[model samples]
Target: MPHRSISAPRHRAPALPSTDYDVIIIGAGSAGLSAALSLGRCLRRVLVCDGGPPRNAPSPGVQSFFTRDGIKPAELLRVGLDQLKPYDTVEVRAAQVQRVTPGFQVFEVEAEGESGRTFTVTARKLLLATGVEDELPPVPGMRDLWGRGVLHCPYCHGWEVRGQALAVYGQGKIVTGMALLVSRWAPDLVVCTDGAGHLSPNARRRLRQQKIQLNEEPISHLEGTANGQLRHIVFKNGDKLARHALFVHPHQHQRSTLAEQLGCRLTSKGAIWINKHSQTSISGLYAAGDITPGPQKALLAAAEGTEAAIAIHETLTREECPK
Candidate 1:
């Protein structure tokens, strides 16, 4: 026993538990890709998980994006992804994030693959660029005509259908405001409140002064041409409202509940509540793009992402070298 001494067991250095990536951007739309570009330029390790096609995938083209206006949504995203190639530290993957678990210093994320498999990743900070989804009107053909005829956001699609016969679909003050805003694009605009035109006295007076027509008949279903152009809004009593396009301020919902899961505060409008630096209620958790408050434009979202990146970089710098 004295001659044959047991050797000490060999052990590899414990794997580093710190995050391999500084940020894990949960969506790869305009915001996520934009943030990744900025962070990547800073030489930070970034992993961008592209859930799928962007929320604007149904739209024909992106508008108001400088130098890239009218570009198709997929093309714009492809360009964003291509532009990131120069940054070696950036990685992009297709993932539908399912769960997030915030830990001591890192957040664990699980994404489900197309094959029903799941993978987990961790990061020091998380950025949720997961935009919102438009819940279209319950009319029969609304879904099919969304982004084309049953539209949202006058600034984005209004130019294409400008001066055409347009109708605003919704009720209450929201639709009243939408009708007024849409009037700028379509002089021949009509406000179809479906059943009740809940316009305020001021709103109704404004509509009358503006010469915007109101239709309160309960809608039967929407009718669109074979080419996807809206033709008319059919009423329950066989009455038809001929229109080329319908502007809708449909209810919107966040595409991902990650913000809710991570305990980020939500605005009354259902957007993620972020501080000036784009950091969410929970420290180290950031949000940008349509998920945040205000308007939802591709250009605006990209700008938000860039701002968030700058803020995240500054925060990380402060944490590392506190003076």
Candidate 2:
């Protein structure tokens, strides 16, 4: 990533100043940072307000990012921030955005920091890259082993859990699909519906033909070893089935509430809808990353951020702001 030189001298804007920035980006995760890098190169005065909670905070490492696979989250951000420093156009504030509103041809941003200080930033445009969170199953011990023994995103953690005893805890058609896909990695695989009738007859037949066991009994809870490794699953019938790892498809929710509050169009699946140029229905407002409906991958999120930044630049150019 190359930094964009500031076309003009750096100057500090007043705190809580009304409508003063070219663009105010929220969240400093992969997507947010990527957007910052792009806009920073264009010499756009960009402020990134982060909630400090990234979507992949629980994951051990990032996956599927070419040439940067398995990189730690902190390390990735460090490199990204370093690259953005020379531009002097991107400022990352460790704060939580409380609310957003349209004011006098710009957007007003109200945010609070850990020090109990609240500040407001006004920008001509707003880009929301706030990512989503994984909604884990309400299973005892599941929370403790999440992102370790139990995981979501096969592409991210699948290689680590490969060749291990695996189980897919899901219902409906998803159970069979997950079981078969996981079976490719783990020879020993089981599909546990946990008493939910989600497996169709065709799916059941396929699993049986593949010699995979279909566990319909309800699961009471999961048991982990002293070292915190998942050891056995406790069924309501008092059966303790030994398993090394479990795969699940968790429910996902967007991180930013301001998008909907501002009346941006949303997809049927609850994601903010954006055009190919990353522009939302609301002019001068954009979104990227896991906030949009798609597979949640670090690379995809980063790419979406880049796209949004380019669109923002074009929009800003048309407005005749100094670049």
Per lDDT, the best of the predicted structures is: 1
User: Cα RMSD (Å) per model?
Assistant: 7.5, 8.0
Candidate 1, residue 131: the lDDT equals 92
**What are the per-model numbers of colliding residue pairs?**
0, 1
TM-score of 1: 0.92
Worst lDDT 10-window in candidate 2: 10-19
lDDT of 2 by residue, 26-59 (tens): 9898899999999999999999987886767656
What tens-digit string does per-residue lDDT give for candidate 1 at 94-174? 889999999876889889877879989888888999998888878899998888888888989888998899999888889
- Candidate 2 has which clashing residue pairs, if any? 172-198
The superposed Cα distance between candidate 1 and the true structure at residue 205, in angstroms, equals 1.3
**Candidate 1 residue runs with Cα over 4 Å from true position:** 1-17
Rate residue 142 of model 2 by lDDT.
Answer: 86
In angstroms, the error of model 2 at 105 is: 3.7
